[model samples]
Target chain A: MVKPIIEVFDLTAAYGDFVLLDKVTFDVRRGEVFVILGGSGCGKSTLMKHLIGLLRPAAGRILIDGGDINNASGQERADLLKKFGVMYQSGALFGSLTLEENVMLPMEEFTKLPPEARRLVARMKLSLVGLERFSGHFPSEVSGGMQKRAAIARAMALDPEVLFLDEPSAGLDPVTSAGLDELILRLNKNLGVTFVIVSHELASIYAVADRVIMLDQTKKGILAEGAPGELRDHDSNPFVHAFFHRETAEVAG
Target chain B: MDFNQKTGCLKLGARLDAGEVSALWSAVGGRVRHVDASPLETCDGAGLALIWYVQKGGATVTGLRPEIAALLRPFDHLPVDPADAPPRDNSLFGQLGRAASQIWNDTRDQVAFIGEFTVTALRCAVSPGQVRWGDMWVIAQRAGVDALIVAGMVSLLTGMIMAFQSSVPLKQFGVDIFVVNLVALAILRELGPIMTAVVLAGRSGSAFAAEIGTMKVNEEIDALVTMGIEPMRFLVVPRVLAGFLVTPVLTVYANFLGVAGGFFVMMALGFPFMALWNQLVSAVGVTDVMTGTIKSFVFGILVAGVGCLRGLQTGTGASAVGVSTTRAVVSGIFLIVLVDAVFAAIFYTIQW
Candidate 1:
């Protein structure tokens, strides 16, 4: 069995008086595409933020590569941060920088690579996402899908052990979104990088996810956990079944 | 990682990551002909990049690790070429030509914006019910009422400083009584209106630019246009009207506060309160106050108009709103000073 790259035990997330997630327990194994899927307002984004240490969990622990993310400090914390990369829903590329410069920013900050080597590495990362041709273009100049791809390249700049994507296919069309899924699969297969994707796109989930955990807004916990196909075909939970089958809860109920 | 200089062979280590591979390139150099990856246990993207970098330099890498080979295979066909450099115009004449063109284009845009605003203002004037009175009231409270304290404080300090400075030199010539005339003339004719206008330029002008610029960036303005709404009528007119109405009122209030400040200095200098009041009434007239009021009205239009113009002219990208805001403040102050100079010349020529 592959060792878990991330271990979450009894994680609780809340915003002040309102709790969004409660006693959420899950583990992501090394080199697999693990997805968190739920409908709107289901706390998928909240969980992703907590996993990346952007938000503090109200209760429980999150362990990334054997180190407790909450307890680590100083150099240890910086080292832990370098272990994962995040691509936000908006692509979040700096408007002033070209795509190559955006990819090189992480390397410039974290590595001791010479300028020439850094440029070459940035080009390589862009090439990985098929964005080498648009390296000189700004984020505003590219299509939404291309910007997302450039963002992925920037995320891979430091060769993080895990990559977290928030709603990667939310605004993309079927073709562009499928292309992104293919890119994600290729990167995972070739580099053996773990992917933690937060998405509700059924086609994308079935295409790339090795394992998935479905969260429920009302229950504030995982409703189902299994392969996408298994959950879609045989899950007993009404909410999980409704989600996978694209049926309203009323019909499934 | 170990590299044999004489044998032209590079040996990989158990772990190759970003931190460990930084020095790998320097050690391998260009002389590397073969890479021995049989001993390699783990490699990341950066490590793969290093290997690819060597392979692209014509070195043959031999290894039995299927996993690492899979990582390198995808990028193997990608050509190792440098990115195209951004174009630059380094010559002095090229730079001058660009600057001249930008200035000419900016002047043309400014004139066109003024024409458009004039047409909108006239249309709104014809149908007064079309104006957004609620938005105008809100802008009035924000730009005028909220600004009273700062405007009054600045006016008061200016009056006090003028009185004290003039009194010092006048006392030397036994003409200290003339200090009241000097303070009244300066505050009512110039200081009050100019100070109030400057405050509005910094406060309301920047806010207008930032608000509109953000709307432009978010495509909200485009949405308004698509909905058959003119942005100038829907947005700029209300703010401009509120500015035009409030500036003169603020200027009058600032003028009173400035005179009060001068009264304090005169009282502190042992001059009788009644004597200073009588002197001020005789020296300052309705025209003196009217000149400042008229200047404030024009300054108000310039400041608010420039802000709205900059906002509507906002470019695309993350820094667009920021750039527009900066331009609003700069252009607002510049226009105020230029128009004030014209006002000064007219007043001087007429001996007002």
Candidate 2:
């Protein structure tokens, strides 16, 4: 079995009195595209935030590469943070910077590469996402899909081990979303980078996810976990089945 | 990672990530003609980039596993030429030309905005029902009532400083009691209106720009336009009218506070209250007060007008609102000082 790169044990996420996920546990293997799925208001985003150390868990621990994220502080926390990158839902590129400059930002901060080398690496990363031609364009000058692609290039700037993507296809058309999924798959297979994605788009999920964990609002925990195809065909939880099938569950009168 | 210069063969390690690859590139300086990936177990994006960089520099790579070969395959067809790189154009003439064009474009936009504002304002005057009195009242409270304490404090300080500075020299001439006349005339004619407008420029002007600029960025202004709602009528008119109405009143309050501050100075210097009051009343005529009030009205228009104009002219992206707010404050103050000079010239010509 592949070694797990991330381990979440008995994790509880909440906002004050409003508990979202209660003692949820999961593990993501190295170099696989792992997705967290759920319906609206199911705490999927909250769980992703907690995993990325944006929010502290109410209970339990998150171990990333065998280091406790919650317990690490100062340089230790910064070192842990260098191991992963996050792409936000809105393609939150720094608007003032050109695409290449945005990609070069992390490398400039974290590495001692010369200016020319940093520029070359930034261009190469943009080329990987097919955005080399638009490296000089600002975020507002490009279309939404291109912005997302540029954002992915920025996220891959330092070649982090894990890339956490929050709703990579939220506002894109189906074709653009599929292109993004293809990029994700290519990156995962070629570069062997692990991806932990948060998404509810079934088409995107089926296309990129090697494994998935679906959170439920009512359950306040993971309702199902498996490969997308297996879960669609065989998962017995009604909510899971309904979600995978895109059916409105009929309530018992 | 290691490179043998004699054999022209570069050897990579088990983990070839960004940090290691960067160090290796700085060392070898892309000098290799051959790469042996036989010992390479894993390579990341930057590692792939290094290989591509070497390949682009005419290196031959051998012994790559099938999976790694496939990863390197996609980057093969991409153009290695730098001809398509974006132009920076940072020469002195280039910068001057860009700045010139930007200023030209901003001036044009400001002219167009002023025309639109004038038309809308006239329309609102013709049909008062089209005006948004509710928003006007709300803006009035925010731009006027909320600003009183700061405005009063500033005015008081200015009055005290002016009286103290003039009294020192006037006392040398044994006419220090004339400080009352100096403070009253200056506060009523120049300081009160100008100081109040400056405060409004910093506080309410920036707020107006930020609010409207945020809406412009979020497409709320576009939404209004699509709905056939005139943003000028719906958004700009109320704020401008509020400023127009509120500034003169605030100036009145500021003038009172400034004179009171002068009176405080005079009282401390052993002048009786009634004597200072009688001197102030005799020195400051209704015309002096009217001139400041009229200037405040015009200054009010300039401040709010420039703010709304900058907001409506906001560009896209995260920094757009910040840029607009800054432009509003700067242009507001600039126009205030410019028009105040014009008023000063007019008053001097007319000898009013």
Candidate 3:
């Protein structure tokens, strides 16, 4: 079996007095699409934040290839950040820069490539996301879906080993969301990049995820974790069953 | 399996793309000197560039298919073109047009905000219960009263320096006592209010812009709008009222410190304390104190108004907060000086 790229050992995440995720554990394997699934308020986003080192876990540790991310120094964290990329829910594109410039920002910061090479790579990344035409457009000038695509392009600028996306399809229409799902699958398969996405959309989960971990709000831990088909077919947890089947609250926990 | 040591050949992978090029090429290194293109599945410019780099390190390329060799030819060396041109707006006329439009928009927004604020101010005046007394007290303590010590120190030093400088020339004429009157009139009539406004512009004015700009960025302002709360009344009124009430009091405090500073300097110049006090009293009338108080009140409105206006006009993103904070300080100071000049002219014409 391939070694896991990311390991979470009894990770506990909290904001002050409120604990969102408690003692959750999981592993995301290299070159596989790992999806975090949960109902609203289940701390799926909080767990994602912890994995990306945005929030230091209140307890336990997160290891990225045997290095403890929670306890790493500032420079170590920055080095770790270059190993993975993040696409926030709102796209979080720098509003002041055009889409091409935004994609070039990471390259300029991290790579020794000359300006022309950086621009070419930026254009290539934009093309990968099907946003090459919108390279010169400001984030505000584009549609929401284009912004999300541009953000993903920026995230991939450094050719990160892992990509973390937080609800990439939240504000997109179904067609656009499906397009993004297809793009994710293409990148994952063609480029052999690992994806760890936090999403509750069953369609997206079924389309791109090789494996999924379902977090339960009441339990504040993993309710189920396995291949999507296996979990949907046989997982006995009511939340998991209800979620996969899109059942009404009558059978939901 | 791809790299055969005996044959000195490393076969490329199916997806020889940009991201994989560096890692795969490094793995092959210059040790395996021959690259076998027989099993090469795909490649791009970046992949070919890496192969060319390895070939330059004394590695040889052999068993290459014709099509793949043609694909690799263009990237054999770095392109000799100039760097990508940096994006910019270079047209002077276009910049001027944009600046004019921005100024027009800003003025219109400011006028509309002032109208909304004045309506809220009228409501607060008529029915004070609509104003949140608790928020007012907190803001007053944070933005006004807490600033007293620094304001006092600065005003004191300013008055002492003014007295020392003026007394040097007066002492040559043996008229050092007149320094007391000069300091008193200056502090009570102009310097006190102006200095107080300058300090507040840097302190509470920027603070107001930053705090509200952050809220605007975080969509708290949108949340307030959705909740059917008037942000102008809910947020701006208490702050404006706090500024209006506290500024004049702070100016009064500053005026007293300035007089004390002047008295200290007079004593060092060998003038009696009572003589300096008598001169100050004879020189400064009720009109001087009133003018400073009224000017401070106006300056207070300008500071709070411009600060909140800049915040409310904040655009999106992290840099927007910083831009609003800077605009608040610049415009707040400019408006204060302009209003003071207008006040000076009116007072001069009326002989107040």
Candidate 4:
């Protein structure tokens, strides 16, 4: 069997007396979009931070691309982070950078490539996200959709094998969210990069995800994990059913 | 409603909203729309209401899908454009004139992160590079200009006063020669540095805090950290270094003007200018002027340090800017006095 790109074994994360995530064992394979669906306080974003080495787990290990980050040093963790593109939920674009400069940031920091090469890479990445014309625009000058795209381009600038997206479609209109979903699919198939997306946007999830990991609050752990259609058909839990079909079910009744 | 069937799980992203238009926008989505919408509305005491016209551009822009952003690129409907925007906000010009200094602070933070090792090493005490050349430039350019403007104006008036006040004493004692020393020594050592820093603490120092504090409240700081930047090196060091280097020069200038004032007074009272100049030279010591220049340098550091530190302490939101600016000025002046007292105590003890 192929080794999973990411592995979380018996993970129990805590903050003071509060156990944020308990015994969360999961594996995300290479080159597939996997969505983690949960409510606001269900510790999903916290979980995302842990996966990216921004937070530590109280118990258990997180191995990314088969290297253990739970036991890694700070330098090692940063090096590991360089391998993954993260488009933060809030579109964490630097205010000092023009949209073009924001995309070029990673290339500038981690690579020895000169200014011309870096600009070319930034332009290409921007073009990938349909933001090629906005290289001169600042985050404030562009629309919200464009900002998210530029952020995505920045994340992809390093050409990572794994991408961590925290709520990629959080604030977008349904149409824009659909466009992002399409981009993720294209990136996964074309670039062969693994995606670990934390989102509760139902339409985007149903439109894109190959598999789902539902964090059940009452249980404080994984309630279900499987292909979207399979979970919808077989999971007896009403919570599982509501989430898998949230797109068709949320707005109407 | 069973736990599963409730299906409210999707609202997580929107829950961070604590604002007036929570219904329309949430989290990352909220501010962009509000910032854009501001250009389209006007305030006539309705407490920041959105006019119907506010939605007109949004509608047209949204309908055109992709073309309208290209078409409306060159115009601004809002006054001052909120004084925040990249390229504009990131430049030296923006740092001086921008209303939203907090935004600039965050942007500078990104620079620090990129140059973290250089910044971290330079700021370390091994070399005592707490002072930096970039900071020297900013202080010389921005803070220096402010100090000169205020000190020059205030000194002119102060000189006028010295001339007027010393006339009576000089006429009676015919010791008008002493008046120049009194003005020069008093202004140089004690009054000059202290007064100049106090005024700057109110003017430039507070302005620094307000700008940085506003960006803090806006999640601009968060943006910097995620991008691997340090806010301290980019934002704090430059301004702190500036204040440190520039304050002493203004203090010395104030001293010269004070002596000029006394000279004017002595001449008006019929004590010859040459006589006054000679007597003042004889009465004054280099120690007195040196003591004041040292004090001014210390005061300048205090002013800049307090301003930058308080700006960093600002929380997210517009109101935090005002709070941080007040803290910057108050703490700067307070620290200046505290340092002055320490200097006074040490000098007396050493002399004994």
Q: Point out where model 4 deviates above 4 Å.
A: A74-78, A245-253, B1-352
State the DockQ, from 0 to 1, for candidate 1. Answer: 0.58
Clash totals, every prediction? 0, 0, 0, 9
State residue A5's C-alpha deviation in candidate 2, in Å: 1.8
DockQ, every prediction: 0.58, 0.50, 0.25, 0.01
Residue pairs with clashing backbones, model 4: A239-B4, B101-B211, B102-B211, B102-B215, B103-B215, B113-B229, B113-B230, B217-B316, B217-B317
Off by over 4 Å in 3: A9-25, A55-62, A65-80, A217-220, A247-250, B1-89, B123-129
Candidate 3 docking class: acceptable
Clash-forming residue pairs, model 3? none
Which ten residues in a row are the worst by lDDT in model 3 chain A? A111-120
Locate the minimum summed-lDDT window of 10 residues in model 1 chain B.
B79-88
Evaluate model 4 with DockQ and give the value.
0.01
- The candidates, ranked best first by lDDT, are 1, 2, 3, 4
Whose lDDT is greatest here?
1
Per-candidate TM equals: 0.95, 0.94, 0.83, 0.50
Ranking the candidates on TM-score from highest down gives 1, 2, 3, 4
Preferred candidate (TM-score higher): 1 or 2: 1
Ranking by DockQ: 1, 2, 3, 4
Isolated chain B TM-score per model: 0.94, 0.96, 0.79, 0.61
Question: Per-residue lDDT for A13-70 in model 3, tens only?
Answer: 8899988888988899999999998889999888988888878899998988777877
Q: What is the TM-score of chain A alone in each candidate?
A: 0.99, 0.97, 0.96, 0.94
